[model samples]
Target chain A: MSETAQRRGRGRRPAGEVREGVLRAAADLLLSEGIKAVTFDRVASAAGSSKMTLYKWWPSAGALAAEAYFAHSEHQLEFPDTGDIRADLTAQLRSFVRLLTHEGERTREGTGSVLAGLIGVAQTDPELSAAFSEHYSAPRRALAVAAFEKARDRGQLRAGIDLGILVDQLWGACYNRLLIPDAPLTEDYAVALVNNALDGAAAR
Target chain B: MSETAQRRGRGRRPAGEVREGVLRAAADLLLSEGIKAVTFDRVASAAGSSKMTLYKWWPSAGALAAEAYFAHSEHQLEFPDTGDIRADLTAQLRSFVRLLTHEGERTREGTGSVLAGLIGVAQTDPELSAAFSEHYSAPRRALAVAAFEKARDRGQLRAGIDLGILVDQLWGACYNRLLIPDAPLTEDYAVALVNNALDGAAAR
Candidate 1:
């Protein structure tokens, strides 16, 4: 076997398997050490892949980090259809806050820090910026929107309500706290967000 | 007088004057060139001050950038209490959206970009992080909170409302769009955010 082939698992593993390994390694780095730790060299070494392979798959480090974050968060961030919008929203947001903060026995440690770093770097990197929205935010937001639509159909929500604003209020508030961090991003805060947003702040 | 004194205009400029000039120069670089261009070398040359002076005033590049952003935006981001909560919020949000987007005859080209860059860098920079919240976010948030309290006093808002969520819902949505950018952060969107948060989405 060629040295290159031997280096890349002696041509034994499938390309898809290799890619998954790469993503797993990258996610581990992101969750453990934050975004700055997901370098080409580190990810390549961790995944037993070459820098060339990483470059071929992702346009930039930020892009790779973005995908890694989505991969790591995909299952954990799903909205449950419990037929109660308030309960489901409250549960989902609590889970999200834990994921961003001090979740136990999961992708803890630097998850929020990693996310903040990815967001920070995305401002300047076009490929990373697009990857973040396409891979993560858009899909995640669509899930919330679908859940809200179901609730609306079931008469849990008011008619003529903009579902997008619902997204901006609840989830966007978390993002604000994550980015700016002037207030505590606790589960209680999440529950308060859901309740207040649904109940309205106007005096009846 | 020594050559060094002559170079700095023979110490003709006061320390306060030098600091103000440095801030102006840093803000200009941030607005026009984004965060990367506001290095000590670049800022010192632009402000006609020494790198030592910049370091004496600010701990890091991110720190300087944070203060510069606050200095530039102080006048533009104030909340006006026009006696009507909805109108006041809508106007404030519209103005904010314009500031982040394409307003003419102002800091038009890259205000949002600079803010995004600052927020991004602050994630990894302790000095920048503190400076961002201390100089920009905390003070700015205080302005909004005061206005909301006035409206609450006037019985325009429901009692026992979470004011932080109000800030998050309106401005946080703006920040979310700026960061994740799945949808438009337009004036219409801003108005909708304000109206919906006040009116809410309950079927009752």
Candidate 2:
């Protein structure tokens, strides 16, 4: 029945609209119900489209979930270049923590859970892991790395510094807290992290 | 039938033997077949015990899995006080990365997958999350924190540095890499991370 509808005007929605609708539905389902609930059929029905449309775009539910999460995060997280690397990074971290922990109209409270579910699925699914790292993690890391590079060129960063590890130090702490659930990702914590990373922890 | 067997001398094994056997069986099942196969009955049968014995120890499969993973990790990870904080931390990170990514006799390649599965389960299961944090995470963090505090007292670490944040920066980077499959936790990378965190990322 859905296949016949797919053949007939692709469920009466334009291609771009259908794609957007499907991704939106996928994101909603994933954030609310988790990765397991974002099946093609459920997304298609939620988006008021057909399963054929979802399958045409996403080869599997993992692909759909990856795209959905990427789309959601891309809109929420922006790497700002405000000249002051410290402020820029602290703002970015705060925004990220907000996105992860906040319960708002568009963002759900279970973002960490959704991410954890995806990580679990990605462990077994190489294709999904690649798609997630490429689409979600790489872009974000690239932005931060670029900012650090700019800081280096501006003589703001230490010489011979490995930007990759620096980025890891800044972001890894938050990820650790998120995974452990022991420490809350507060604004103060973000400030302290940026300060501690920028100022050597060794005795002067 | 299993209940009858449980009443009859607790499945014929001593209490400690039964507990150890069940945990060993649970760990094997978790590492071999993933989290879903670590049911109480499955673990009991695999350990040559009965379901009643399994229930007498762990309340749920998540509890059993947590205990199993913890038991496996406790034997592998130890925070050694080698006096030199730098070498100690770098060595610890190397060992941890190995445990996370290496394939060995007791440790398998699927350690990350097992952890990822636990993280996913912990998201929805508060009881499991608490158990995992209290039993696995808190103790480890405390050990690291105590080491850092000792370093501070010895004037090896900078004054006014928050050891908690310091510890977070060190371990968080590794956790982030473990969660994100883009980067491998190389030993050199671990050393660089420790140095960068200690020396600060800003221009010296």
Candidate 3:
């Protein structure tokens, strides 16, 4: 639903503390043991709580994992919005690549392992899918869209190129690099992508 | 480990028939029940085998899940190389997008879910990475690179754009689309990507 709904529902003041603890434990389990290890029991044990406590809050392992990943990673990512469109976009992307390559190892796993599991879980479970769309997918997507819109406003993007598609192109490279063998997320590669996106490839 | 060595070690006989059986069971479980429902006992029971057999092959549940994913999805992908660089690349990319979007629904959980999870697994686990690379990532990468090379040979590309980085930018879009919540892959988007890669973005 809404951020307010997630922020304030069910219990009183201590709920926030309990939720944070649960998410932390889930993240820990995912990093140390991978996706399969983040069971309700494991999360409960790690959080020094019970399975009921987790289920009451998260509803499923995927939800718990998604929240934990966002909690851990969102802070690490700061979207730069300098007036200069090219410089700002490049800097933000470089930061993202560096984070993916270095600081955000577990976060990457959280997205891929736990969040992916949640998406798969959603395919079979309608309740999980709704939860995922609201809590995990939408917020992250909105941020990227907002960034592109800002870029367009600054006159960096061409008139016809779909912003959504452009975002996909930029992100595809990162995911491909991460998934492929011996694929390094290099500055040269990143620069080429940015340049290509800014100016279309029609032979001059 | 050489393919020859691996094959010779297995002695052209079923070295780990029971283990393979468990993996098959795990694959089935992953397909039917999603990643969350897969269990060691269930896999063993489904395969008409024992937990001991599974343990001998895979150390943990994630490991089992990862292997099951590789076994199921590794064979389904192929990167073709037609003489028409643009058309072949488009066809190949379209196939990949379809897999990521459609088969992704069916096999993603079993394949261990998420673009990031796949990458993380590939990084730490050499066998899994090699399998992922050989079967999925490398072949497509090589195909795309070759397509660009073919285009260059035919004088279709500009003089300065790095082919390696260009391929990454094009394929990167696909990866980014799947990794995040973006629009579904369409034929128009694929064409645009091919056109962009072949010719520099600057207008003629």
Best by lDDT: 1
Name the lDDT value of residue B128 in candidate 1: 94
Clash list (residue pairs), candidate 2 = none
> What do the candidate models score in CA lDDT, each in turn?
0.85, 0.78, 0.61
Q: Would you estimate the TM-scores of all the predictions?
A: 0.92, 0.87, 0.68
Docking class of 1: high
Question: Which clashing pairs does model 1 show?
Answer: A120-B120
Provide DockQ values for all models, in the order shown. 0.82, 0.65, 0.28
Ranking by DockQ: 1, 2, 3
* Winner by DockQ between candidate 2 and candidate 1: 1
Clash number for each model: 1, 0, 13
Which 10-residue window of candidate 1 chain B scores lowest in summed lDDT? B102-111
* Tens-digit lDDT track of model 3 for B111-150: 3244435444444445556655655567766666676776
Candidate 1 on B154-185: residue-level lDDT in tens? 99988888887898988998999988889888
What does the lDDT read for residue B76 in candidate 1? 68
lDDT (tens digit, per residue) of candidate 1 on A1-204: 777678667555778998999999998888778878989999999999999999999999888988987887534657878889999999999888877787545455535767788888888888889998898788889988999899999998998888988998998899899989998899999999998888888777
